[model samples]
Target: MSRLTERLHRMLHADDRLDREMAAEWEEAPAGKPASLPPEEVNPDTPAEQPDWWISVPFRQGRGLRRLLVVLSVLLCVGIITVLVITAQYLPHFGQAGNPANNEVSRRYIENGMEETGAVNIVAGMILDYRAFDTLGESNVLFTAVCAVMLLLRVSADKRRSAAYQLELETDDRMYEPKNDLILRSIARLLIPCILLLGMYIILNGHLSPGGGFSGGAVMGAGLILMLNAYGFRRMERFFTIRLFRAVTVCALSFYALSKAYSFFTGANHLPSVITPGTPGMIFSAGLIPYLNISVGLVVCCTIYSLYTLFRKGDL
Candidate 1:
């Protein structure tokens, strides 16, 4: 019985060992290679290309390199975030406006007999005389703006048809009707010429009087606007057209530039005036101050009027 039991135990142990071996062998067995053409059938004359070393090299290297790249990318991103957090605290400091230098320069110019420029308006003095060069540039800006508006406003009938793929329709004729409000229209018609005259007077007298070109020109523009609003755009358009405004603007600017240049050669700071206004305050006090005012007035008035017309007409 003891021998039989011992034999049975040995048999059980051997069975367990065989089962383990079988399991291990199943796990370790290589997977079947993809079925390939038989070596004998792979014709050498048809070109047996060498295995690409370069292609395999990249794939082999990329596994380790991909891990390296990921680590570097994480480090770089962390560093950038840290730098940004540090920088954000001081960013608002730039928005703080604190500057004394600009005020000092303006103050000095004001105290230095800028009154000799014949501008009662200190701002005007800065505009028409001190930064006269800048004014010239500004006028050119106005000119450019006017030209752009004109181009935009002028829609050719054919272009309109092409855009809509239909016949062009005429705009509402009521938009051009003469103001039948006889009382207002008549009053505006009478008053407009007078206002225009006054504006011209102010502009021409800019060198002599406290008023300068800008104010005078603005006054003139107001008169023009009054006429347009009361009578309609057609009346104003007839008189103060885009072409007319352009010519006037160019001429006015040229006159200003030429006068300044002539003053340089003659060693005179101002134009030759028929009457010089004596001292701080007088009607004929400043020599060419009134005239300069007039020039500025006309330029400003005409430009504003032109822009207004273009805008109202849907040109720009």
Candidate 2:
């Protein structure tokens, strides 16, 4: 009876060991190799072939689906081009004098724009006086974009290293220094003032000349970028700090919004305006256009500088 019990116990232990081995084999089977089969199930005379991995993955199995996708993409592009071409044919021809755009409204604006807005530059008058609201919307858009970028990219003070460390980092002249390039430095020195002067001229004379706030601001931004590249951040920060940037941008945008709101209200109501459109060709002729240009320039300048500074060092 004791010998019979021992045999039964040995059988149970063998079964358990086999079960554990099977479990381990199953766990490893999906990892590119097949589990070992029992000796009784294996047939040595006929070798078992491994199944192709690609058979389970539909994308790798055939080129037909990829070709179909490519063909459909090409067809979609062709259809879009065909639609655009057909639409273009129905559109009015370019530079046609009798086009709907050359209407009485345009004529009135052209004829009386200078007298009404006191701006010699008809384009300036049209943008700032006639379509002042549109320009305001554009300025708001710029401000919003700057705000968004700042929220996304500007690094907080807590995230930055200590001021002493930052000063040490800046003192690494080899990082972005334009060193030993005397010619380049000399040229930059010569051109920076001229660029700044040209930008100011464009902004101030926007009401009397071809350029305006946008163009002049772009030029000024370019000058600032040039100065940064040539002289480095340390020198530029002496005058154009983060505080100055905030102050200038806030003031400029506030003034623009308030003044434009007043102008829009008075013009829409056909009320008498206190602002007198000065002489047509003088420097200060346009009642609010020059001031508006300066405001826009300030906002634009701050935005450009801030963007560059933030992108370079993740702070300003």
Off by over 4 Å in 1: 1-108, 118-121, 157-178, 201-211, 264-288, 314-316
lDDT score of residue 294 within candidate 1: 56
lDDT of 2 by residue, 216-302 (tens): 988898899888877777888899987888888889888988998888788789998887798999997888999998888878877
Indicate which candidate wins on lDDT.
Answer: 2
Candidate 2 residues lying further than 4 Å off, grouped into runs, are 1-103, 162-181
- In model 1, how many backbone clashes occur? 18
Residue 143 local lDDT, model 2: 72
- Against the hidden reference, what TM-scores do the models get? 0.53, 0.63
Which run of 10 residues does model 1 get worst, by summed lDDT? 47-56
